[model samples]
Target: MIHLEFNSESENEGIARVLAATYMMKFDPTMEEMADVKTAVSEAVTNCIVHGYEDDQGKIFMDISNEGSVLKIVIEDFGVGIPDVKQAMEPMYTTKPDEERTGMGFSFMEAFMDKIEVSSESGKGTRVIMEKKVTGK
Candidate 1:
């Protein structure tokens, strides 16, 4: 398992993607699968930056674990948590409507990852755990 924590900033989204891709490389996934992993990671990190912190300063924690053919990722933030996780997961559900957010972050993550789990506390934080199975290595 590899752990990373960084400022909850938009620029860190790319860092999260690259880290996920690099870790998955050892699994020898196909190009398409790599893309999927990157996209899923990006969405999770973006959520932490945009929604969790809501532009306030905070820290985002990410954990990546590789178990044979499975990769599990957990991204968390100790910021303003979601009040309605179910509603947030739905596509086209954006709290920041004025910012032009597409509200597809969770949808994209679900589409790419095999499984996803989210838990949040109103004033505590939000945690997103996702897993993907890679074959062909």
Candidate 2:
């Protein structure tokens, strides 16, 4: 398993994403798959700060592991959680478009990961878990 933690801040999100992709490489993902995963992972971290944290001070946790044919990634943040998950996951949906959010973060995650599960409580925090099959090249 690989673990990562970063300040739930924007400037630091890129570094956290780089670490996530680097660690995920241990699974021997294909070059094309790696690019997709890297983009998805970076988007996830950005969501933790821009959406989950609302650009406030917070913490983000990432856990990566593999079990048999499944590759799992868990991204947890201690920040404002989504009150309505259904709405949050919708394409082109964003709470802060004024902040320049593409509103495609969750959509990208859904597209990249084979499956995604999310749990969040308003005022508590948010956790996003994604799983994919690893067919190494």
**Best-matching candidate per lDDT:** 1
Cand. 1 Cα-lDDT: 0.91
Over the stretch 1-137, how does candidate 1's per-residue lDDT look in tens digits? 89999998788899989999889888889999999989999988888888888859899999999788899999999989999999999999998889879999999999999999999999999999999999844
Error of 2 at 114 (Å): 0.4
TM-score of 2: 0.90
| Cα lDDT, all candidates | 0.91, 0.82
Residue 21, model 1: Cα distance from true site in angstroms: 0.4
Weakest 10 consecutive residues of candidate 2 by summed lDDT? 16-25
The prediction achieving the highest TM-score against the true structure is: 1
Q: What's the CA RMSD of model 2 in angstroms?
A: 1.5
The collision pairs in model 1 are: none
